[model samples]
Target: MNIGFFNGEFIDINKAVIPIDERGHQFGDGVYEVVKTYHSVPLLLDEHLERFEKSATAIHIRLPYKKAELKSIIVEGIERAGLENAEVYFQVTRGIAPRNHLFPDVPPSFTLTVKPARKIAERNYESGVQTIIVEDDRWAKCHIKSLNLLPNILAKQNAVNSGNFEAIYEKDGFIAEGTSSNVFVVKNAVLYTTPLTSNILPGITREAILQIAKEEGIESKEERFTKDFLMNADEAFISSTSVEVLPIRTVDGQIIGSGNPGEMTKKLHQLFKGLC
Candidate 1:
């Protein structure tokens, strides 16, 4: 019962609704957000919507619908899908245009789809997941959730091919983030992660963990740390809208902490799930 939305109407998820000359299809000229729902309610929807609008504006693409209209679309799409847990993905693109490098004077195209959320393995959370470190090769504007993700996918595929769960990006000898998640390390009971910058996406789950840490009085710092620091941390993990707070067990084949899901990682994830 997955649902798809394009232009102005809902359709089957498999429908080929986008035109061949669509700017998004041609040049990845768009910004997208993925919202996860639990018990038929999207979590942190308002924050996601705010970030979505900011990303579209950053890329100079005017969204076809207002915030209210977009919310209605999402809610209806979720209902149509009829799934208690769903992954709602939506994007605003620069619209259809002939082959050209310059911007076209056409309206933006908005597309959305709602489907069952992908489930990560439960054992991975219990044992934690392995990761490989890769050099950050993406553009400088990583803060904007743009559709250009070639480098990210490449690194991610490399990690998967190497039997790792995720790829952590190291820029200038320090950890920037994971290919699709934010990196965090707990050292001597203090949490640390890369600060907000043009180098990493401001992850919703990462922010929630930080806020939860503040509420629980767990010390946290939003500052860059070296790869060596991460490798030797007491505990480490990655966070995203999908993974929530998945623990990291290894970096480059070296065991992290006791090579198990740390107590704090478990507690933080338990608290994060409470929000859902």
Candidate 2:
């Protein structure tokens, strides 16, 4: 039976519940982290927890437990699930309260769920996937991994309707990021991606890939690029905790480079897997 952690207790998944007036449900007031596990151990767990704390602080939500306590809770949930590979999702909300926009006096609500990880299709990694450009409609504080994701949901659905794997968001003609990943472009054998700003989430996988690039002696830059640059680049890819290094062969029906996963992307993927 699946198990989850909620309200400081481990319980059967079906028995877990959050109050109706919980701020996360009523006002989307929460921050979350998704840690992918390998061999029953969470990969980059420390980095994920650090980012989670930063996200909560950005939204003024005080986490109920310390990082060490939260880590123990996650491990316990994973042990209960008994899965070798899984995705551990944990979140902290402003807490249960009367329906109001103001911050409540009660402690924050912490919840965690562990489930089997879904592997991306090998064909996608081999032949790459198509994506469409969508106008970014999220709020200014995109850096925070908040529960407010209406715009991202709409854009992701739009990508699905367009027969694409993901949506690359653009703000004022500048490529920002993907609906759930970070965008990177290869131009003249150099890598370029958006810098850490309010326009995009500072993805943990994105940072890992950059570190790999540096270690592998691959040239990289964290500067923003225009739509034309993205469309005309030699190659492109998106990265996330789940997706890892997903190559983008086409964008809005325009072929990228040779319309295949680039050499640099394949190398980075192998290096990333080594780290995992």
- Put down candidate 2 lDDT per residue, 1-276, tens digits, no spaces: 366888888877888498899989998899999999999989999999999999999988888899889888999899989999899989999998999877889989998889888889999999999999989889999999999999999999999898999999999889999999999999999999999999999999999999999998899999989988999988899999999999998999999999999998898999999987
Estimate TM-scores for all models: 0.99, 0.98
Question: For residues 1-276, could you state the per-residue lDDT of candidate 1 as single tens digits?
Answer: 899999999998898888999998999999999999999999999999999999999988888999999999999999999999999999999999896999999999999999999999999999999999999999999999999999999999999999999999999998999999999999999999999999999998889999999999999999989999999999999999999999999999999999999999999999999999
**TM-score of candidate 1 on Cα atoms, chains taken together:** 0.99
lDDT computed for candidate 1: 0.95
Worst 10 residues of 2 by lDDT: 1-10
Backbone clashes under 3 angstroms, per model: 0, 0
Q: Deviation in angstroms for 232 in model 2?
A: 1.2
Give the Cα error of residue 101 in candidate 2, in Å.
1.2
Candidate 1, which segments miss by more than 4 Å at Cα? none
